[model samples]
Target: MLLSKASLEAACGRKTIRAAVPSLVSPFQLTVRSLPKQQTERRLVPMRRSKAVSVQNNFSILALDDDPIMISTLQAYFQRSGYHVDIENDPYRAIERIRKTHYDILLLDFLMTPICGDQVVEEIRKFNKELFIILLTGHKSMAPPIRTIRELDIQGYYEKSDRFDQLELLVESCAKSIRQMRTIHSYQNGLSAIVDALPAVYQLQSLEQLGGTLLETAAGLLHASSGYLFLKQSDETPAMHPQKDPELFCTFECTITKEQARAQYTATVFPDQKTIVQQNKMSAPLFDTRHSMIGMLHLVLPHAPQYEQVQLLDIFSRQAVVAVHNIQLHGLVRSKNNELTQVLGKLRDSYVDIVSVVRLMVDARDIYTRGHSDRVSKFSRRIAETMKLDRETCERVSLGGLFHDIGKIGVPDYILLKPDKLTFEEYNVIKRHPDEGADILAATSFFRDIVEIVRQHHERVDGKGYPRGLTGDKIFVEAKIITVADCFDAMVSDRQYRKGLGVSAAVHQLQQGRGTQFMPEAVDAFLSLLDKEHGKEVLSLYDTLPSTI
Candidate 1:
């Protein structure tokens, strides 16, 4: 049904209106000189105002109406209401405004010139996809047809019968909307600033420097009194041996200890700023590079009242952990590159360099057993010396122990440290150690003897062992000697799961397993050597282990 002018005005009640720009434009200043009133003087008069207002820099409202009085009234209303409202008596000018500057809200005259309000609305939409438009007309019939509003996503339609009252409310309502939008914008800006400043400070290399960054930036953003960052390093020196570095920390906990953190660092690293002012949870924020689980960061207030916001502190703590992890990954790449570069350099050395390099690797694997391969090699030489083996044979025996379990490099840390029983699959994996050891030895020159020893280390007297199990004399004497030493070490050294038996108990177990698990002669020789040197005195040699460690 066709609608009349009064019907449209009747439908236009007092509903709220608001202005929101999808994008904001920054404003620049233009100082203009005032021009003189008389042409005779041709003097300049001070320009009182520019086309746009300072506060309205980010927003612009375009108003179009054919009636000069009505258009002038609406313009005056918006200008006083803090809007940079552009006026267009010609509906075509409204179309031009959209093409030129960005406008947030469009106020169009339903009774405008050359183009009617409805036609103007349609054209404005084509060029200004985001401009929100409202229709204004004195004749209620001039208001948009219901079909247009429902389909066009238009803001609203206003009737002009009560021009002064309706236009004032329309202008004020859009202003309130702009104010609320500004509120949300300010909040978003603050949030972005805080997050952006974080990575800048967290990248500090030294703990003290990182701590300072955490404290300063955190206090500035979170309104924290002070805070600290904590971090930890993961040890990767093979699973048979475990090592840990002192955890790094960034905290505000006035008094905190490593023992205390070890007990409770997993819980809330960010204490509620609300509760922090109320009680201490003994927790702190933790983070590090390498993408590793760095320790926590703690934000502390000397007095709880000193901090009004701890939630921000918590957010920072969580972000720091994520940052630390990335740093650790970067460090790992660098370390691996260095290791590969070193390996490439070593590739140029001689055949004897292979044996020298293997000895160096064993010594370098862990501080606790830095000289272990060397010591075991010496022992193998003495035993061979006693047997009056050939010079080359004796040398092979000594070097064999040096590379005996070198295949261990293939074992993953978790599996190597398995503290409990293994499935058949896991045991099968463990069985590959001998072959792996052999492969490592065979990779370089002058290692054929050592390779043979590694490959045959698990082969037994009864032909029940792996990788071509050889019975009796089929296994090399040197290989048999390594089997004895390997078993002795396994039996006497503590593992991830179990404590080793003392030397005497281990010797007894060997005696029992002889001919079944070991050769009887090797067992006899092992026991005779321990009998000469007190087993108790050998255990005492490790007393130099760091007393404070």
Candidate 2:
């Protein structure tokens, strides 16, 4: 189980691990620990102790700085790595401490009080000759720190103004130096994690968490105070996140961020003590599919130095390239996945709509014809199988049967759902369904093939049919198949106001009209299959059959 900050702090008897730490390592350094079972007061009051926390450990650090925020940030970053962090805020106090105590690492702030920064470092080396001294400066000045390094044997130095990503690298480098471990690229894993969680567009809370998580992990490797991430929008609005703006989706919530801490960093911003804080846009990205190097991540330092440029930002730039590639890949996958999901949903809806509309039309007719299209569609598909039509063709034929009477949408309602037969006017109106359906369908682009089947279902094999008296050879083969199935189902169905025509009579009617109404070849094919086991199975599926009586 992970310990809460309150519990850990209470157990340690300190507000933070740094102040509680002692210079020398021992169990006596346990300023606080497993608490009393029951205290007179649950709240532990803060105490100023003479001893340091984690002094019994192998390493000791003397972090010297005037800015408490900067000291706190570094202390916390190192504390998580299981190292002792001791702060020396006053420059006078820092030099005195270095003279008296034994320290493994010396962290000195470049800008401080009471004495000059370089003077403190010079004095510290005077007493503790072998300390692994590191200058934690708050500026981008090369001359002061570099001159010292060139002159003396300074173990390591970190720029406070470096992006947290850089700080993390420095920390890792320092840790690895002391521990004698190999250095690894901090970016490979960060880029991979971000890539895995992509398409860049995520829910607000999730995105914020991702930002912090990636930066923190990256910082752990870079040894920086924090990291920052920003994306450029395709378009911009002046009043950003104006009113509950969804555009302000990305955020900064990490304790480790590019927020201004009280640390004096050696920034390469200005020659004097003046700090420059320019907010540059992360737009016009250089990232793309084949090669990705996006907009710059300005590693803004509080003060300017003569020798800071592309080399200083190189590590971040390389990592940024990976981030761009992973993010773009995520975007592509998400877009395609969303598109496919939508398409599949539409196809499903079309299937439902087709079945419903056809059923509605059939219901508009008599009860006996209620399941006509449904059953015939099923049987026509089975017939298509024996005809050896490909699966796609078979499926289309089945769908066409369901919509064969779509032209009936144009048929007068009185004549369509009517229980009685047609008068002269009703017959003419009924005959118009094929043309009406064809016209209705011609308006849409994709349904032209379906429209052909609808237009010809009424046309008979003989020259006596209504719509286009186009006899045998004039009809399409698939339409000829539907015409046969249409007659088979219609004859077998009992009219609303008539006794049902038994299955035998229905089949006998078709056999008699073999060459007259249906294509003889089509009728022969359907009957041959109907005489077999599967045909009987198809017939048995319905309560009544169109038997050739």
Over the stretch 387-427, how does candidate 1's per-residue lDDT look in tens digits?
66789888888888777766656666556657788778888
Model 2: per-residue lDDT, tens digit, 1-549?
A: 012222432353321111101121111111223332123122221111222343334566777777665576557555555577788788888777777887667777655556756787677667666666666543333225345663555655554431233444444445555543211232444344444544432322332354444444333433334334543321222222223332212223334333332121212223221212334211112233333222223223323321222222344344444554454455556667888988877876676576457557755554556667777787677777778888877877787787777666566557776777778988888888778766665654446567777788788888787688878788776777888788777766666556657667877887898888887877777887767665668667565533422
| Each prediction's RMSD to truth | 20.4, 22.3
Scored against the true structure, residue 167 in model 2 reaches a CA lDDT of: 41
The global C-alpha lDDT for each of the candidates, from Candidate 1 onward, is: 0.59, 0.54
Candidate 2: stretches off by over 4 Å: 1-294, 297-358, 417-421, 435-449, 461-474, 496-517, 532-535, 541-549
Q: What TM-score does model 2 achieve against the real structure?
A: 0.38
Which predicted model would earn the best lDDT? Answer: 1
